[model samples]
Target: MTKPLISTERVQSSTGPMVIASVLNSPSERTSAPHRHARGQLLGARRGLLTVAAADHHWVVPATHAVWIPPDCVHGLRSHGPFHGWSVYVAAPACVDLPGQPCIIAISGLLREAVDRAATWGEGPMDQRQERIAQLLLDEIAVLPAEPLGLPLPLDPRLRRISQALADDLADNRSLAEWAQWAGLSGRTLARRFVSETGFSFSQWRQRARLLRALELLAADVPVTTIALQLGYDNVSAFIAMFRRALGVTPGRYFIAAS
Candidate 1:
């Protein structure tokens, strides 16, 4: 499938304008290898889901959210299906006041509209009106609230082994003790190091992994019952409850609102 027209080398040049915006439309799935740009980027999907991975952080960006990638951050992108979105690239100097790390931020209506308007501009220096719109976009990004759609990965090799296993098989219901033994670490060490490394207990991290997976499956139009079963949930109600607790809305309602 064809990828979005974002070039790291082109966007990162110091001589480029302060902000560069582009609209993305893909009829099928697309994937970009891990890469870095000297320019920071704000990427959001308007009609589908995007999975963005940067360093040890992974974010599931729905239509209502955007992922901010700081300048020179190594990252990759994978679209869940057809994708229609926008990307705004900022010069390195202009990113000094923006987010210092990769995160998923809630996209406000004003920011969305501003980006849409900016995406239509032709190449070259911006006019006074365009400059004002660009500033507005930057202002909105600086203050937008971050959403809890990111999963932090652990740094320890043993912990990564366990984490990767869980990600590969969300239905794995191994207890902390079982996982510790499997990884050749003591249960206490596993629990403590999990919190220290990923800022989440083992169980909490697994739940978050499941939540993120559910979102990917949902974007592909998976049935709720099937998703619950696939994620090892005993019933659909339990899965829905967990999703609602994390996102403050049921799965159906969340996607409905996003659409």
Candidate 2:
């Protein structure tokens, strides 16, 4: 569970940079409110999925994936399920040549530990070794893989109505053609608007929405088979295949590794 929203404060740290703290909760515990920060942020989700809206793009970050938010960029953070994480601040002046896009980086065991370990030390200058370690950690961040969790949904009223109906019934198993008919648009028009406005095809967006719901269900420790059925998959294997393709790991593995 998350505590109430609190004001953002920059705390003086042992090093030259200031540290900021923010808490994340499960999707059921909060609503998505978009915002940004003054300093670069290392968004760590110890559990659940984190959906971040940065600029015109939105990213769904699962466990083992962290979003590196650059300074002065507007963004929103929301929990997809029971979530616990940290927002570590790195002063902007020291950040250089960082990827400008909202990034989804795979967390190495060592880098994850460094975050905690560095936090444990008091405000002070790091020795030569610690500074080197910090630089290496930043280097790892630059190469993180971009996960394909974002699904663009158009803002058209007719399309939105149809999309909302599908969201209301994720288990409907309706094809794009069916939705197009319901929206009173041809299949080509539906596909075109989906790509033009949302940057993804109708089929791709539906799969992501289903996957997003699946991650939330899994985080709540809901049974895999049950979640598979709930998301309209014919069987657990089919769902698992989709899940692995999006995340590069199995449901069980993701859950266990996250734990």
lDDT of each: 0.82, 0.67
Winner by TM-score: 1
Give lDDT tens digits, candidate 1, residues 117-188: 988888779889998998998999999877777767676899878886776578988899999999999999
Question: Tens digit of lDDT per residue, candidate 2, span 132-218?
Answer: 666666666666566555544466888867665665567888888988898898999998998887777888877887877787577
lDDT of 2: 0.67
Which residue pairs collide in model 2, if any?
Answer: 14-123, 14-124, 26-81, 27-81, 35-75
Where is model 2 more than 4 Å wrong at Cα?
1-7, 11-28, 81-83, 118-137, 153-191, 211-227, 240-259
Clashing pairs in 1: none
Compute each candidate's TM-score over C-alphas.
Answer: 0.67, 0.66
- Evaluated at residue 71, the lDDT of candidate 1 is 90
| Reference-based lDDT, residue 19, model 1 | 84
Q: How many clashing residue pairs are found in candidate 1?
A: 0
Shift in Å, residue 52, candidate 1: 1.7
